[model samples]
Target: MTALRPAPALLEAAFEAAREAMVLCTADRVVVMANEAARHLLPSARPGSPAPAPLPADGADSFQAEHEGRQLYGMRRELDDGHHAWFLRDHTEELARTTALEVERSRTAFLAEAGRRLSASLHMRRCVRTAVELAATHLADAAIVVLPPERRQSAWTRLLPGLPVEEGTLREPQLGEVPGLLEALGGFPPIPSRWLDPSQAPGWLVPAGFGPVGALLVIPLPGNAEPAGALILARCGPAAVFTSEDEVLARIFAARAGAAVSAAVLYREQVDTTAILQADLLPPELPEPEGFELTGAYQAAREGLRIGGDFYDVFGPAGASTDTVIALGDVCGTGPEAAVLTGKVRQTLRALRLVHTEPAAMLTVLNEALLQQSSRQPRFVTMVIGSVHRIDHGRVQLELASGGHPAPLVLRHDGSVEEVPTSGTLIGVLPRTVVRPATVELAPGELCLLYSDGLTEARGGPTGTEQFGEGRLHQALSECRGMPGAVAVERIRQLVSDWVRGGDSDDIAMLAVRAPTRTPLSLRGGGAPAQSPYVIAARRGDRRPRNF
Candidate 1:
């Protein structure tokens, strides 16, 4: 018997049982044959009905087609009977996997770039702004950085395409004003992360204007002893709920920003403290004794955190109406400790003035006091002290004493400069201080200048290594013989500041006392004073002619 051909019904039944979908259609695209898998994939295709769309006509060619809500990949073949045939496979699962991988890769790249931008600045405000922009752009619809109440401000930012980044500050709120914020501020992880509708958000969160938030994350920024602040990220509309990966990124960014802000805050505090301390150490106001005009200038060393040890003061005539004391001194070092010693020296002198009227005697007692403390503190001072006693006709007698200091210069009315002759070992050393006293009469239109070594020892020139030297200081003073006391002090300060190119050298202190010009009536009856021409020329802002 001849092999029997498999019946058409049996062949169709085999097709129905196969897993792959199979469809047979005429060239005109009418479906004539379809297996159970094919009918399940495309319910719209029936025998004697047109195919859903044109079938692929080449061998093993793949094309996408929709069947109900499912996506199918079709492999087409041309049958021997001139009908069009296709093998269909469901591809929706594979497509979803690929798309997810692409999204994850993009997010990873975004995080790395965000981190770089955030760390680019150590400035507190700039770091906060960078963090806000990054989060709003990549991680959330809206972002907020809320500083602790002590910090006093908050920042908000959001992602709105085609618009500029929005940012502003809100005054920090009291703890009781917002629910759950305190817990977050305590460094606790937001449990299940906060999810709230926009209308229900706390007042602090309202500035961000995140519409209908679907998920919110509150992460604390850590500090050494406490939480520095909180970072709030909110997603709105249909954005995906924050995942574990997102939480990790938020914590990292906040930590970096928090560190930078804490450093800035601490730096500002240190600067303010330094300013107050320096102000206290320096003289507040100069003493203006009768028959005298006085001015003083103090410059701290410009180099470091330390204010220098140079100091000056003018006070008194306390017990003796005719005597006023002026002192300029320098301690051995720079910094807060040296500054403290400067204050001690000034106070000791002030106290000594009440008991001692003579400059030499007063300095000897101060030396004893410093020597007593030397074993414990071991510092010395270089000083020049003067007592001005008024005499006949607008003239004063200066009893000057020096303790290992640059001698004071007396710029006389006749344009002659003289160094007061006084000398001794620096104070706070040697058991007994030997201070030599010299007396000079400061006539009308004369000035007495007392200064620390910073003026004479300043290093500068064409080579920038030479000391400004006493000769230069003398020349500078000789030019201002008849100027007011205040003008003389300021001129010297400006010269030294310019000489040093505003660099940090040693601390500088200067004090000047000027006597007023005498009237011709007081010049022993109609005799012209030697100071007359210079005083008149100085008042006109001009130099005196040599023989006038």
Candidate 2:
């Protein structure tokens, strides 16, 4: 405010002409003269009376008070003749504006914090719990969040101060018993607080031991396609009745909580769907035939996902049959998209087995079937499909067809690894894609190995970029000369894993089929030949094969 002083002659005219209310007083604290504004502002302070209480106390220079319901500001200014003037003005509008600004700031901060806390929850139940807890703490005396009904029951979470949150399923909630709840649950606009009578609230809507309700607020938590649920807020006494502004803030808060709960519900649905997908796409347990042991290992390229491009399955022969169908394949890429194609290939092969089970014939039919897909983008699968047969004299024979896949390796009894020459054109591409079929014979102590390219192509070494070539894989297998099928497969997988050392990798899969070796009573050549540790473990029933 600008400095103001009045000339003795012009003081009365200045005080009267100005809009400000001014009262002049003597050193004795007695009122001497007053302007029209001051006379109207303080009707009781006349020329002969003392000043009113609106004056600043304790010799203060300024004061603020309420006069006849109007907010007033007063200033004391001293004059040269042992007199002073009290300048007063109505400042109701300014103070109200400041108070409103502060209230808005508080509401904004509250909403921001609420949004942060709500969005952090991904589980639907936890999100509901958090919503009710927050509302109870800040918006009302108690709160409850009710989810959509299912199976003739509705799930609810409720909270109150100094008490653990409560949750349970209510059999057929009577929403009509509570005013505005049915409308809110239907996603209609909320009803004003004044319209609801606390005494009419249903007992189930209020937590136990809580006194009579003062106010109730019900609002829907909207979702992407439908309402996620509804929120119920209550106050304990008449003094806490929600104002119009309080209702508006509650609505805004409900909007944020609704969005968060909706997202959480959507995420949970996806997780459930993914679980089903993983169960279907996961490789089946490899069947162990008499005198034939098969073990396999698999790891998807995408972390946290169980299904990937690489896959393997073993179908044991029916009664009296000697051959067990084994198929291991890798799609072009290494994620869900490729895994889908891998699944299609596996299912198509199973379906085609009724038509033609021969390795080459099955490949031909699968190639034609894949080429018939409706996808615009090209997709192909590299596979090693074959059958394991336990022949006479305890030897195993393997007949397989390769479709643009890495050649299979045969581990010899003397620790020598030989690669089978069965590389062919990748399936799902050329209609006349060549299918190269090969045959290998495993001696009593030998084994046949089928694997995906993720093994030899794993990238890591001292330089962290070197590929674990076939030479390293072969050398690793040489160490597992007399090990069981599962042990050999695990050995190869472990070596590849070490080679990568936690670096990015493609989908890896390996399968090994070993012929049983004879275990003798003595270490010498007296009875049967000395058995390997794997065979001893097998006899002890402790050889647990890896789950495919």
Predicted model with the maximum TM-score: 2
- Best candidate per lDDT, number? 2
Model 2 Cα shift for residue 274 (angstroms)? 2.7
**CA shift at 256, candidate 1, in angstroms?**
2.0
Query: How close to the true structure is residue 518 of candidate 1, measured as C-alpha lDDT?
Result: 70
The Cα RMSD of model 2 versus the native structure comes to 6.5
TM-score of each: 0.71, 0.88
TM-score of 1: 0.71
The clash count of every prediction, one per candidate, is 0, 0
Candidate 1, residue 126: lDDT: 71
Cα error, residue 292 of model 1, in Å, equals 1.6
- Per-residue alpha-carbon lDDT of candidate 1 for residues 408-471, written as tens digits (9 for 90 to 100): 8889766778777678788988888988767666678789899989888888776777888898
